[model samples]
Structures are given as C-alpha cells and as structure tokens.
Target: MQATPVNPHSSPLVRVALLAYTFLIVYASWYPFSDWHTIGLSPLAYFSEALPRYWTFFDVSINVLGYIPFGILLMLACYPWLPRRWAALLCMLAGSLVSGTMEAVQTYLPSRVPSILDFITNCSGLFIGILMGCVLTPWLLQKDLLRQIRVRWFVPSMSNGLIIVALWPLAQIYPQGYMFGLGQLVPVLSNWLNIYLGIPIDLGSFIRQGAQLSIEQYWLSETIITCCGLIGAVLLFLCLLQPKAPKARLVTLLIFICLGVKSLALALLFKPEHAYSWFSPGAQAGLLVGCLMLYGLAFTPARVQRHLAIFMLTISLLVINFVPGNPYFTDTLSTWVQGKFLNFNGAAQFLAILWPWLAIWFLLHYQPAKSTNPA
Candidate 1:
C-alpha cells in the first residue's frame, strides 16, 4: 500500500480566512468609529483598572465566541512557517496582543468601555481555539477527507474567491431593501456626508430624479436585483470550481444557504411570522429565473462564466445602490429589535453593503492559475 501524498504547500485559504476574520474583529471592536476623546489617562488604563463591576455572562460569551475562529485560523496560518507548538504559543500571544490593543484604544471612545474581563475572556477563547486547531489541523491539511474534497473540487489557487463566496451567506444576515440585494452605498454615503460635510444628500432618490416608483416598478427593480445578485454570487463560486465539481449540488446549496441566512436574520431581527416575508413574488420569479440561467450556464466555458459573473455583479451593484429604498422594507425595518446585537448587526450590515463590491473586484482582477476546467 502506498502512502497518500500530502500537499506540502501552505494553505492560502486558511491565511485568507485569518486575515479576513482579523479585520472583522477590529471593525466589530471599534464599531461606530466615532466620538473619540482623550480623558488625560493612559491608553493602558484598562490594564491597571480593576475588573469591571458590571459584566454579564452574555457579554463574556460573546467575547469568547468571537476570537475562537481567529485563534484557529491564526494557528493554521502559522503552520508550514512555524512549528506546531510554536504556532500555538504565538496564537495565544497574538490574540492577547490584539485584544489588549483593542481595549486600549476603546479607552478613548466615549461609547466604548475598555475592560480587563474582555481581554481575559478573549485570551481564553484563543486558547481553546488553538487546542481545537491542534486536534483538527493535521487531518484537515494532511491526507484527509476535507483536503481530498478541496483538491478534487476546487481550483488549487482559490484563496480570495473562496473567501468571497463563503461570505455571501453571511452578507445576507443584514436586512436589505430587496432580496439578495447588497452594496447599497448611497445611504451610507448620504449619512457620512450629512454628518461630516453637512450636505444632506439622498443619492438613491437623486438617481430616481424625485420620481415615485409604482408597485410594478418596484417589483421589476427587485426582480432584476435579485436575479443579478444570485447569478453573480453563484457564478463566482462556479468559476473557482473544477470541471468535475458538483455544480448543480453546490449551486443549490449556496442558494439555500443564502435563503436560510436571510430568513433567520429576518426572524431574529423582527417577528418570526415574517421570516419568509422576503420571498415576495418578485423574489420568487427572480430565484426561478436565476436558477434556470445557472443550470444552462453550468457547462459554459470557465472564461465566459467569469466574465458573466463580473457583468452580473456590476449590474446588481448599480441597481441595488441606485434604486430608492422601498417603503415596505422601511416599515418592516422599523419593527426590528436591534437590542443586544447592535454591534453584530452593524458588522453584518457592513458585510452586506460591501460584499458585492468585493466580489466584483475579485472577479475583475483575480485569474486563477488553475481555474480552467479540465474535460
């Protein structure tokens, strides 16, 4: 019996995941990014201050749960560079360093309170994550089931593309004006201008030229947005996959995952009864059409698929950002309870608003060395 050959190269996917998660951690920690002032105390005041008098199990759990993935990814990323034991130690130290820096900076933010408890809990999460990674990394990166599947299905160089595709479902966690609609920068830009430049601008409405859209117009806009967004995201993934990959199964799974995330987000943010409210007639028609389009394009040339992905993403981004906000969606948003998950919702909104843009960038510039499908 021959021993299975394990790829000796470092996994780019793990490295990309580590970097992405680190960015998310930084963004989530300093959410809102405003109202910074120095209180004449050292930034390290949190280090000397006693434990926070007010803390909850939920807060501690959230802190812990947040850095676990970071720790695992960091450990794996250090692999093929550093020894396993060293990588574990470095992961813990790096996690503590990052948490401490975040806490130190929070001292200047009026809305954020730096706490030692958070630092400790974050370290604990990193420790746990390192241990878990130790147990799983060998099997995953070596000759294991997951490694086999990845090698067999996906292109060898798909670090960036894979990350973008994986984040698609997560981007749907934030409520949107239309189903599968994302990258609406108009509102975000408008708010920024209003705050900083005192220029009250509604870019979306400006694009509409003060014209009110009828019910039919809204439906048409939504259907176009949904179809384009779905095709863009699914085809982006398809471009990364090998010719022999299970295109149908994977595409269906991706759509279902996005739908499930969107439904769960709606239920959690609003009422459970309204979970499937996004499944409007326009969305249904869009989904059907998108599915049919993808089925036909499954066997298309990889280069054509990549170009179509870029084109679809560009269309979705333009339509989603230019279309005025839907009144019905506004009313539904009014009912949302943004209580404990304010920071989380903010991060999700950031992802939703930026995902399509990132996907477009990837599609435009990233040409995988192995993206060509082998017959």
Candidate 2:
C-alpha cells in the first residue's frame, strides 16, 4: 500500500506559524513587567511569584490553556506530512525546545524574569494544541473544515499581512524609547542622519518640552517615534513578501510579529511609563515606506528579496546601534571617541540591549531569504 500524499499548503503554514510563535515566546519570556526595579528584584523574580500560586487553578488553567492552540496547530501542521506517532514526538520536542529557549533568554531581559511556570505553560500549550489537532484532524477532514481554514486563513498571500497586523499590538508589549513598535530604529536613524549631515534637529529637546496637539500636553517625541516606527515595521514585512514564496512570506511575517511582541514586552518591563508613548508620525511614515518597499520586494524574484531583506535588517540594526550616543560611555569618552571610535556608553548600552536578540536570531537560523517554495 502507498502512503497518502500531504496537502501542498499544510506543511508550510505549520512551519511558518511554529517558527514565528517560537520567536514570540522567546521575546515575551525575556521582558518582565513594570516595578521590577522598585521591587529590588531581577526580571526572573517573577518565577518565584508564580511558584506559590503554581498549583492553583489559575496557574494550571492558564498554562494548559494558553498552549492548547500551539499544540493543536503544531499537530495539524505536522500530521499531514508525517506519521502520527512521529508527528506527536516531533511536536513534543518542538514544544520543549521552544519553551526552554524562551526561559533561557528571559534571564537577559531587564524586565523579563524566567520561570519554570512559563516553560511548563508553553509546553502545555504546545502539547494541548497537538492533542487537539490529533483529535480534530479526522473530523475536520471529514467536514473539510481543515482544508477550508487552510485555504482561507492559512493561505500565504492573505494570511501573511493579517498575521503581521495581529502581532503588531503584541510586539508593543516591550517599551522602548520609541513608541510605535520595534521601529525604534527610525527616529534613531533620523537623529543619526541629522548629526551626520549637519542638519539641525533637536528631537530630544522637542520631546522634553511638552508639545500640545490642541489642549493635551502631548509628548510629540513619542508620537513621532511610535507611529513612524509601526509604519517602518509593516513596510519591512511588505518588502520581504515574495509572490512565488508564500511560505517564506508567512514565515517572515510570523518571525517579525514575534520579535515585535517580545520587543514591546521588554520595553514595558524596562520603562513602563513609556509603554504608551510609541505612536509617532516619523515612525509611522517610516513604517509606511517600509511596507511599500516590502510589497515591491514581494513582487520581485525570490533571490533578490532574500538578500534585500538581510541587507535592510542588517543596516537597520547597525544604524540603531551606531547612531545612538552610547549610553554606557557617552560621558566618559565623549571627548576621545566622539567621532572616531566607540561611544562607550552607547555601545555598551546597545550591546546590553540587543545581544540577546542577536543571539536568538543567530541560533534560529534567521535567513531572511529562506522560503517555502515547494519546487
């Protein structure tokens, strides 16, 4: 007897979603909630907070509840491609690996505290999701709901944009100086351009001196950062979309969203007050341009989009890091390293903040060009 063929669409969607969710968990685990400093505790202190309450209904319910979808989705994605037993085993491994990684990274986030509960909860979610998928697959296939959902919600073209939009708010959980989202790079880049080009722009001062949009004492600085930042993120996603590589597009969007969520959480953990300050036009415009660029790239050939994505992200990362006055050595080395070398404070700070992300991105094999081209 011959084995049945897997649906062309199922596997890719599952892989993309799984990879993206993994990133999200890692991002969320790192950032802790506000009051971390006032409590005189590290971000991982929350692990203890969740401990005494571990056995309570809330803890178990939340843990198991949250991951049910993950497990189900993982199972659904895998079942079509692998043997049932093998798929189950794979799901379990994937769940554990993702949860473990998130817990490990949590140690570095100033606001994020690692916890056994989170690991357990994440695993539970994966397991439950897998189990649900197993139970529902047969019925879903019978009713054709599986195929319907896959075609409708999981289709690469339609799903990619929606998933990114959904993940947008989640990414804002991290509180950075920039408001909108991970697009903090925009304002930082803007400031860098001003300084490098000898253009006079006083963003810092503009932010501090309360600018009003009518009667409200608005922080125009935050508004510019957040709005423009979000636009930039969206554009970044759009730029990576490849018409022939739906799977790649889906995967990219998922990863981006997860990163966005984690970034937001970290922002909140470190600077809760600035959590709501991410709605700026500069950031928004950047995001819009980014989205346009992504759309253009999506229509381009796969090979070109891949390199372009990598180049864009790399440049953005570099700008975000190099342009800022190093928070760590700015005062001490202001005179010596001003234009020639390192801003001790800025470099130290950038490293402190982004090193974890770099590590995760590296470990995850984050190839901007890796695609879902079945061919």
Residue runs of model 1 more than 4 Å from their true location after superposition: 1-8, 48-58, 144-147, 368-375
Q: Which lDDT tens digits does candidate 2 get at residues 23-124?
A: 544434443223333344554455555454434564456556657867877777776767666778888897787667666655554554467766776687
29-86 per-residue lDDT for model 1 (tens digits): 8887888899998988777889888787867897898888888888777755666777
**Deviation of model 2 at 276, angstroms:** 14
In angstroms, how far off is 20's CA in candidate 1? 1.1
Candidate 1, which ten residues in sequence have the lowest lDDT sum?
Answer: 1-10
Candidate 1 local accuracy as lDDT?
A: 0.84
After superposing all C-alphas onto the true structure, candidate 1 shows an RMSD in angstroms of 3.6
TM-score of each: 0.89, 0.42
